[model samples]
Target: MSHVANIMLSVDPDDRPTVESLSRWLQTSAPLRGHGPGATGRVGPLGGTTGEDTRRGDGGFPERDVYAGALDHADLDELIAHVERLAWRQPEFVHLFVTDQEQSSFRVWRFHGPKLRQISPEGREEEVRPAGGPPDIHTRFALAGDVELLRDMVVAAVNWGPGPAAPREAVLSDPRNAHYVDGWPRPGDLGLVALATREVDRWEPAPVGAAWLRHFTEDDPGYGFVGDDVPELSIGVDAAQRGRGTGTALIRRLLRTAREAGIERVSLSVGRDNPAVGLYTREGFRLHGRDEGEDSLTMVVHLR
Candidate 1:
């Protein structure tokens, strides 16, 4: 699971001082902790195939210095966000390039405060969703009256992302899925809803995601049922609400709640192709088994 990733960053010449500081910190930070001999660093005008054409088309931005290094995927993600934050704080724009060990997939990002976005190879721009949850996001216990909300979230969870979602009725009508939300908030059912505010002064926040637990008997085990005693997790964040760490926050908090409730373990199922598997893995969920007759995996996390 610890794959290496190469990161390249281009920042305005005026920000060289900041880049230098960041370089010094990177050499000794938690990011490079377990790597054998640490990493190498070099500051120069942006080179490489990906940067050459783009830098040429950048007009009069001048030849900004670039910083490049490689690190473990987990630490790479953290380092990328840290670099993005530094870019956001800079007086001008910054460009970040990330690629896997084989250099097969390249992602480009531009950081400019409230205008952050990722640039595709085709020159298409899309909003960049950071990993950590923002300050405006709030979490609250899911109430019984939130059935409709949970239903919608269930659909989002099933689809995982932008793929076509089954009609709400059809999705919930299935006995398996229905058990997740039907008779919401039954005794021993625990859950939380995450709400986010678009504006700082906004008094009310819109619900963006939810996570809940349901118990099952051995005779009728859930898709990810590990034992009759372990609660199966059902979680989903609105499509528009993902990538901001809302799902992560919800899962982490819900797991803590489970531990406090005397539960020793939690279980869940995710599709083999679902990107959320990475998130779940990072949250300490380990593969238990393949769900029979399904293209999904059953995962479990020990709370004790």
Candidate 2:
């Protein structure tokens, strides 16, 4: 009978000590980190571990090491491929290690994930798994008090990744669902409020005035502007309360107000690079234009 064994190993410059210790430990237990006859291993550039020969040096620093033995060649090959893919996706260079106890099967793999780049002194960027390419924005109206719930609803609208699916119907059916309608801030709804700031003098407050004051005490304190005429969609969510449809619910409620007001359009602005663009786009908002001075995109939705 053939024996099966599997292990996962990773090395990262970001995790210097851990990688070094793991490499040394694997070496001591078995001849997995160094070269020898009868022992199987592979080494190459971060992404080139899929071919037959494992020993093509690339003259690169932090080369990945894979040690394998005592397994059908096919299984070992698959393991190497999987590890290499994972490594290539990591932000920093990484090496993978695997070991099999029963038949003494072991292997190592390496790859470098997307690298981080600095776009400006204050801005840095990293590649994210594409979420359905560019996002599509939709607009909806919501009530003032239901802002929290609406945000959650919007988040539930899109499948962020392969986790448990969110409860779409339940999110939509809730009477509190806000962003489902158009022309937010119905005739008598409270105006959205802006947190008092030095910039307060820069823009005039809505003539109808703000009814309720809500401040997002997250990384940034965002003010909500609720009123009968002004658009009142919530932006950002509580760090702990995000990803459960709060943003969607908030937008839906605002849309409901808009529809009631007989308003056929609603709009908001977000920084071009804001992650919230994904959620806004999914909710039916679209980029109508851009504000170059502010580096913001003016997104709008038209209601029928």
Candidate 3:
């Protein structure tokens, strides 16, 4: 079988040097790193089919130009790092897609946005490290100690309160709050956390994010609660580490955890104003309904 990585690189009109330098680098380096053809392989973008025109000016990005092409999975990250070094600003627009065409699937390694495959260039394959890389985190089961960690993540979820978040004390005040995080990681409750370190992980050496499910009941439904079987999800990334791909990593890991646990579906409630809605949508969560308050929307993802 064949596995191809189709990348879409874009930047604003009056772009920065990181972008210009990236264009220059790709012009020279892609040829060196790419395989199978002269330029990009046959899957190059032709028209609007590849989401080339999907531009949103919400996050401070005004306009964008796309660099779309397909390459072997091996060359994907080098191209992505070129985009990521420009992303520290968390600008409104910077998008990329690394797609596997065989499954009609693609993962946005950066959309100003959000990794895998090594970062080796053609010859000195082992020398270079991943650029704009995945956070140095490992996924692990939620331990009993995660209660405190979950408390912080809950605050992190709502931009750390003083505004949109619910009272922190209330979220973890009682056992009835189990749907969210009061008594997290219950019997059927599967959770995964992203652990990192200051010295090695580029951040604090601690658990920074988590994704877990709690099967809710008819009388005690979660905010995004659907039913008893469809466990509601509560996921949050560290406030200090929002834009650097930690959220994406945690979700991907939790999805794998869900599949292994024989889970059939998961649900979550997200606010319309949350930036994470983009991340959740990208990771396959879809709309179910809006809350009575209308400030939030319920989303669900079916696991296979």
Candidate 4:
């Protein structure tokens, strides 16, 4: 199959050195073309599709540019190497995400002068890694020792977003949401934390995501609660660590744990527009119901 790379760069409009450097790289290095100001809807880097107009302002930056093209395997390698070299020389201003057509490969190299590191799905930065391998992503049963960690993850999970995030205080203050972590591991609470292994400078594994089950009384049912015997689910994954299958892994493992513990089903309430809706569906969750005027979905998966 043909290989293609879609590269997006967020750059300051006034930074002539970086601009010229990018122009020169496109002109001399690979099969890709740089599309910036006035370069609207031109041929996409991956070809066929129209390119997104990057001339418009984005996230406080006046402009961002895209470089895309189909390349032979060798040329794709050279292009990636070229980007790494540029980042090595100018790490401060280099913010890039490069991925292939199939999205089976991605690169967002972290550079420290001459040194280069890759951010694994688990969030650790490792030096000079290869393109593809099973991610170091793994999970462990959360313990009583992780009370503080779970509390922090509760916030992380609630505030997780690719769009507007609710204020932390607002999320925690809600009675419906507060029950997830308020009691500090109630009698039936069980959870697993997805860890990315370790940080570049620290020895402890960093928590990137979490999934847990908790029982609710019929009088105070969770938003997704179906019955007093069914445990409601709560999950959150780090914003940076998402889209790499960490959430899926967490859900699959957590469901297995629920089944092993003699639980027959688990349920969760999620916003309709959340990206994870597709993920939940793929993992066997089916819509249970939705309350009137509510924008969220109540979904359930049978573990029996």
lDDT of each: 0.70, 0.38, 0.60, 0.62
Ranking by TM-score: 1, 4, 3, 2
Best by TM-score: 1
What TM-score does candidate 1 reach?
0.55
The residue ranges of model 4 lying beyond 4 angstroms of the native Cα positions read: 1-134, 198-203, 290-293
lDDT by residue (1-304, candidate 3, tens digit) is: 2334566655454444555565555545453222344444222221222243454556342245555655543344445554555533434555555553322334554342342232222222111112232534445567777787877776666553347767667655645443477665567877766665344332233677877777888887778888888988887887777788877767776775687679988898888778788989998999996456698889999899
TM, every model = 0.55, 0.27, 0.52, 0.53
**Per-residue C-alpha lDDT of model 2 across residues 1-304, encoded as one tens digit per residue:** 2222354444333444443443343333322211233454332112222234643477344444333233222233344443343323333445444443222223333332342222221221101101222111111222454444444534443323346755866644554333332234344443221111112223111111111212222332222222234343434343433454545544554454466657666666565666768877887887775456665566766665
Q: Pick the candidate with the highest lDDT.
A: 1
Report the candidate with higher lDDT, 1 versus 4: 1
In model 1, what are the clashing residue pairs, if there are any? none
- lDDT of residue 17 for candidate 2: 46
Candidate 3 local Cα displacement, residue 174, angstroms: 7.5
Rank by lDDT (best first): 1, 4, 3, 2
**Stretches of candidate 3 exceeding 4 Å from the true structure:** 1-133, 160-167, 174-179, 200-204, 290-293
User: Which regions of candidate 2 fall more than 4 Å away from where they truly are?
Assistant: 1-232, 292-294
